[model samples]
Target chain A: MSSVDRSQRSNSTLKTLNRVFVYTILIVSSLMMLIPFAWSVITSLKSNENVFTHSAFWLQFPPDFSAYKEIWNRIPLLKYTANTLKVAVIVTFGQLFTSSLAGFAFAKMKFPGRDKLFVIYLATMMVPGVVLLIPNFVIMRTIGAIDTHWALILSAVGSVYGTFLMRQFFLSFPSELEDAAKLDGCNPFMFYWHVLLPNAKPILTTQGLMAFQFIWNDFQWPLIVLNSESKRTLQLGLSYLMSEYYTDWTLLMAASVLTLLPIIILFFIAQKNFIQSFKLSGLKG
Target chain B: MKKNRERSPRVSLLAKNKIREALWGYLFISPNFLIVLIFTILPVFFSSYMSMTDWNILSKPNFIGLENYQHILQDEVARETFFNTFYFSVLSVPVSLILSLLFAVFLNQKIKGIAFFRTAYYIPCISASVAVSLMFMWLLANNGLINQMLTSFGLGPVKWLTDPKIALNSVIGITIWKGLGVNIVIFLAALQDIPPELVEAASIDGANRVQQFFKVTLPLLSPVIFFVTITGVINSFQSFDLVYNMTKGGPGHATTLIGYYIWKQAFDYLHMGYGAALANLVFFAIFILTIIQWILRKRWVYSEE
Candidate 1:
């Protein structure tokens, strides 16, 4: 009895120690990830003189917004922001519409060569986007879309990942809903409009948020496609800021903070649904 | 008028015989099929032809019969880029897989403040690569915050971006940090899928926590582990944004991956044919690795009964 009692005590003590150790590591890693953003925000709000001299975490006197003013005035930030919004919004909506419709067809409709066609679509995804670049660019150029937003938006309009994700969601949907819609003298379009699409709102919303994130964050495609200063995306603008190699860390940091805000807000607004859809897609993979 | 009405009679007759299903199907699928063929399939063949010719952005491509492939084989820069990219993946993938699994196990505990920790760890993943790259640039510089911290601790300042020996490794570190969250979440999901009953059985047989983790949990999680490792390796091989944003394959091209090389060749130098050949080589490498994994899975992975 004493031995068992001693063992229990030791186990509980070890468990407590383990908990503390795990918490410490988690806290440290979390802080490590968060610190960069925090530093960016803090530095952005600091004067250029105070940025390097001040302790990494502390502020001296009042916070400054002069860096923000500089970044705004020096770059056509508002114009670039608007352009990015235009491209991201169009691409997101276009992908959601095209992918979901095709996904619904693949998941539910029984057409001739349905499986074979879907297989072909899946095979296209296996090839890297890099391999398709020269050819894609050549096609875009031949069609006279170089240095245009269409060059950026057209290729991404039909995403294999989006279709695959929406297909999984649609597969789990009950067929009874479509049947009921049909019984009410609804046409196929009406059935989709009245029944299927309404049910897919959450996933569609999640897809929209993801698409927004992906398009907004994308750098390479935008850099490759857009060259004109007026046509540049936010990413290209940010890269330009960095390339100038200013000692003005605060201004650079301010730009980064401003760039991150929309995506962070989107993530917070759709956190639960984002996590749910991520799990759903992860399951299929 | 008769022919048109006959076609229309199909609508009346077809509605009774599941024509509604077929109409919706055709409507939904046609747009996607048209776009996919135009963009994906058509371009693949076009690039295959372009790759055989020396086509700059200004002029038409004239076929030269595998000259690009031969050049790529002998081109010192292409060879170096391939080696550098393979080395990056070989280092990054295994380390990331192990670290993420460990983090997932730690997060899976019914500990307090788990949600907060999860969100914090995931913040980097949510942040744009451009933003993260900017932050890392500031952090890893010789006189940057990282060095300042090190100096205060009586350590020598290290040249992060400037030194060729450590520059590539630094990029690998940043890549791992950026990729850590998604991998952890995937592993966490996989870990949770293992039945508690199996762990309990191992414990009842006088196994300790570590023993049960190894004996039961590890075996069960092997499939997810394999899947994650395969995807991680493939993704790492294709890593471009961070290198492009952070290093620009710079400090003497120490961190140049194959993707960056191809981008530079095709876009910067306008060597589209050579770039296409290099891309093909990358595709081949990834394809061969995937096939090897599929074959080896028969030996290593144990599926659930």
Candidate 2:
């Protein structure tokens, strides 16, 4: 009894020490992650001369909104914002439809070359996306999609990662549901539409959030495919802005801040769903 | 007459079954296949053909078989760029993986307020790469945040983005900072999935916490670790957004990655065929790595069922 008590005492003490250490590390790392964002927020509001001369972490006076005004004056923020939203929404829809359909085929179908087809699908994922850039652009030009949103939308339509994620989610769902639907006079199409998709809401939401986040922030493809000033996505617009006024840090930070707000807001609204899906998906894998 | 009628109806029913099944399957899959055919497969084949041609955007592609590949094989700049990228991948992947795993292990404990910490780390992952890179450009530059801190401590202000020698290393540092959160979340999930009973059994067998971690936890966690490592390599090799925003292949091509090199050739220099050749190389390299990993996956991943 005494020996057991002694060990319990030591274990409790050890746990206490461990807790302290863990919290210390977590707090420091979290601060490190947050400081850049905080700095950006501060810099976006700083005066031009003070921003370059003063310490990055502190303010000289009450924060200014002049930089935001400058950013608005310099570019078509509304137009670029609209362009980003359009591309993201279209791509999200395309990915959802195509990826879910492909996932269904992999999870349920008993076609002649089913396994082989799935393997091919997985294999395409191994190919680095950069390799597809030039070729994709060439095809886009050939199809007369260059300088258009279709170029961006079409290229990402078949997302192997999305298919992979949806397939994993579908595989774990009990086959009995689909079997029941079959016996109840429902076809496979009806089973998927009415039965499966509603149940797959959690995974679908995750995939949608992912698709939105990726497309909204995407830089290179838009830079390459879209030549029109008005059609350029947010990131491309910012890069162009950077080049045009290389020394104007105030305006640059302001434009970046404006570009960041909508996504951040979107994230905040869906954050509960976002964090849950992450934990769930991580556990599933 | 009754038997004949019944038999004929049954045969027709079987035929109907075949038609309906085929139609439904086609209907379900047509949208996916159409887009893939138009976007993915066509471009893949188009790039293959482009690799054998001498096309710039202006002129029509002339069929000069393997000329671009031949040039790529012989080009010193392309060779250096690939090597530089490979080196960065090698350096960054392990560092990010290790750090994230460590962070995850620490976070996996039954503790209060863990979610807040996890979200804080993941915030960087969601931040725009262009913005993050731009932020770092100001943070890491001489007379920037980091340098100013160092100078206050009576150390020299390092040339972070300007000096070719240290520029790539700075990019690596930025990548690890950005990637740490995703890695931790992944590993933490893997850790949580390990049954507590196994750890209890190890403890009953007179194993300490360290011993339990090594014997019971590490082996079980190998699969997740392997997955994270491979994905990390792939991401590092294909890094472009950060490089493009921060360095733009500057300081005499110090931080030029394979993806940036391909971009420069295809878009900027108008060597579409040559860029295709380089892209082909990157594809093959990743393909080979994936194959090697598949061979090793059976040794690590332990399925419950």
Candidate 3:
């Protein structure tokens, strides 16, 4: 009995030690992940002279907004932001419509070749986006939409992953609800519009957030398609700034901060939805 | 006879409704189906056909069977880009898996401020890649914070993005940092799914923490590990945005990942046919890797159901 007491004391001490170690490592690594963004914000507010001279962790005594002011005039910041917003909004809504419509068809309807078509859609998810880049570019050019936002919006409308996600959400939905709705004289389109869609709000929000992120951050495709300065997306604009203002760290950091702000804000507002979507999609593997 | 005659009309009406339901299904799916066919399916075939032709976006494609493939095989730049891509994948994927698993294990512990820490880690995953890369580009400058800290420890400054020898590794570090959040979240979810009773039993049977992790927890987490590994490789192979933003495949051809190489060939250099060929090769490479992983999964992944 005395030995047992001694052993229990030792075990508790060991557990305490383990907790200390784990918390230390977690705090340090989290700092490593977050310090860059903090640093960007600090650097963005610093004067050009202080940007390189000040210690990275140091803030200038009087924070400067000159770089922010300079970036607006140097580049068409508002125009680019508007363009990005336009593309992202259109793409998000387009993907939601297409994905949810097809998702409902796959989940609740029994059309001929439905299963085979779903398998094909799944296969398309594995096809590298690069494989379609050149041909799509050619096709866009042939159709005379080469420098237009139509290319961005149209290409992003059909998303296999979004459809897969919505389908999974629909599959988990109870069929009895559909039966009751049908008994109440609901037609197919009415069932989708009034019953199914209202119940699918959570998954729709998740898909909307994801689609927004994808379109907002997308660089390569927009870079290939949009040739004119007026048509450039926010990312393309940032890349141009990087090349032109390679030495202007303050202005560049300011622009980067401004570019990332909306997404970060959106993320904070919908944090749970984002994490939940990841959990759901991650488990599908 | 009267009841049978009454049921016949009802049965025919049900069949008619079934046909209408199927038609509605077709109508609902048509918009997505048509777009996918026009954009995805047609481009796949067009891309394959373009791979065999010589075209420069200005002229009609001229069929030159096998020539583009032979050129790719013989090309030194192509070989270098392939090596760079393979090197990045090999370094990034396993390291990401291990580090993320470690972080997930740490975060999984019952502790205060866990949610805050998790959010901190995941914030980068949602930020724009262009912005993140630009931020890293600043942090990696010779006189930047990283170098400042190094020199404070009596070590000389190291060029992060310029020197070809270490440029790829620098990008790899950034990529790994950006990717840690998603892997941690996935691993955390998988870790939560493990029954607490299993670990309790393991500890009760005289297994220490390390032994419990290896014997009990590891096997249970194999499915997620497999998922992370396969997706990691695929995403690494498709890494273009960072390379484009940070190095521009640069300081030489050191960080020229295959994705960037294909872009450069098709868009920058106007070698559409050759780029199409390289893209096809990338598709095949990923397809084969996925196949190999699926085959290998049966060996290690614990079947829960």
Candidate 4:
């Protein structure tokens, strides 16, 4: 009994030491990951002289909003933001509608070749977006939709991943609800509209948030498709700022901060759902 | 005869419902099917055909029959880009997997303030790539924060992006930093999925902590490890926006990964057919790698019986 007590004391001490070590590493790495972003915020608030002379960690005596003002005046910041909003909102709603409809069909509906078609859809996820970039661009150009939001919206509306996600959620749903609805003489559409969708609020929110994040942050596709100054998305606008004011770190940082604001806000608002969805999707993969 | 008569009418009614259900399924899936077919499916076939042509996106695509593929093979820039892409993935994927796993393991500990650390770590992942890139561009500048810290430690300032020799590695570091959160979260979930009884049993059998981790926990975590590695490889191979925004494959083509290369060819140079061929090659490479990993998964992944 004495030996066991001694051993337990030693083990507890060892665990405490281990926890200390782990916490140290975690704290340091977290700092490393966050310092750049913190630095951007600081630099954005610094005067040009302070930005170059003082260390990034140094706080400017008088914070400057001139950089933000400069960026606002120099570019159509609000317009670009509105453009991004339009694309993200459209894509989110579009993907939710399409993915849920197809997801329900693939999940609950019985039809010939259903499984085969679902497999094909799953296979499409493996094809890298880069492969489709040129052909899609060509198609869009052929149809004269280049330099338009239509290109961004139309191309991104169909999401195999989102459909797959919704289908998985739907598959786990209990069938008794549907059976009861059917017994009440409700058709499939009515059952879906009144029963399934209402029950799927959590998943719908998750998918909507994810779709918004994706479409809002997307750069390459929009960069290729939309070129007009007035049609520039937030990301494109930020990139444009980067090139035009390559040396103006203050302005660039300001632009960066503004660009990330919405995503960060969204993340804070839906932190649990975002993290949960990521875990779910990662596990599914 | 009486039972057969009783079931016959019900079977006919069921068949009718089945037919109607099938039609409804078709109707429900039509929107997705049409979009995917027009944007994804048709583009895939069209690109494959384009790969064999000499189209410049202006004139009609004249059939060239494998010339673009041959050009890709002979082109030095394409070769360099492919090499850079392979180098980035090979270096980044393993590092990302290990770091994220380590993070997950440590973060899984029941410690005070763990939530704060988790959120801080994940903040980078939530930020837009362009924003992250711009932030890094500042931090990596010659007299930037990172360089300032290095100098304070008596180390010389390393040209993070300008020096071609280390540019790709720098980009890889940033990518890894930004990507660590999602992988850690996945790993945390996987770690949680591991049954506590196995570890307790191992400890009861006199296994040390390290021994328990190796003998029990690691085996249980192999499926997630395999998954993270496969997805890591695939995603790293498609690295584009970071390189594009940061270096534009600059300093004499040092950081030009295949995705960026394809973009430059198709968009910048307007060699649509050639770009299509390169894109196809990338697709084939990813497909082959995925297939190989799927085949090999049986050998290494711990089967959850």
The numbered model that scores best in TM-score is 3
TM-score of 4: 0.96
**Model 3 misses residue B252 by how many Å?**
1.1
Worst 10 residues of 1 chain A by lDDT: A276-285
Residue B54, candidate 4: alpha-carbon lDDT: 87
Q: What DockQ score does model 1 reach against the true complex?
A: 0.62
lDDT, candidate 2, equals 0.81
Q: Please give the ranking of all candidate structures by TM-score, highest first, separated by commas.
A: 3, 4, 1, 2
Arranged by DockQ with the best first, the candidates are 4, 3, 1, 2
lDDT of 2 by residue, B1-305 (tens): 99998899899998887677656766666677676666666667788888888899998989999888889878988888987888898899889888788788888887688878887888777778888887787677676678888998899999998899999998989988987877887777778889999999999999988999899998898877777777777777678988888889878889998889999998999999989988887877777877877778767656522
lDDT (C-alpha) at residue B208 in model 4? 93
Off by over 4 Å in 4: A1-9, A283-285, B1-12, B296-305
Residue B15 C-alpha lDDT in model 4:
98
Full-model lDDT, candidate 4: 0.89
Name model 1 segments beyond 4 Å from true.
A52-58, A280-285, B1-20, B292-305
Q: Write the per-residue lDDT of candidate 1 for residues A162-214, one digit (tens) a residue.
A: 88778878999998987887788887677676788889998898888878878
State the TM-score of candidate 4 restricted to chain B: 0.93
Candidate 3 docks with a DockQ of 0.71
lDDT of 3 by residue, A1-285 (tens): 999999999999999999999989998999999999998888888899987676766778788999999998989999999999999999899899988999999998987899999998887777778898999998889889899999998888988888888888889889998899889999878988998899999999998998898899999999999999999999999999999999688999999999999988998999998887667657443
B1-305 per-residue lDDT for model 1 (tens digits) = 98998898787787657665676687898776777787888877777787799988778778898999999888887778878888898898899888888889998878888888878867777788888889888888666788889988999998997788898999999988988888887778878878888888889999998898888888877877877777777776678888888888977878888889989999999999888877777777777766676677767654522
Candidate 4: clashing pairs of residues: none
Cα distance off (Å), candidate 4, residue B219: 1.7
TM-score of each: 0.94, 0.93, 0.96, 0.96
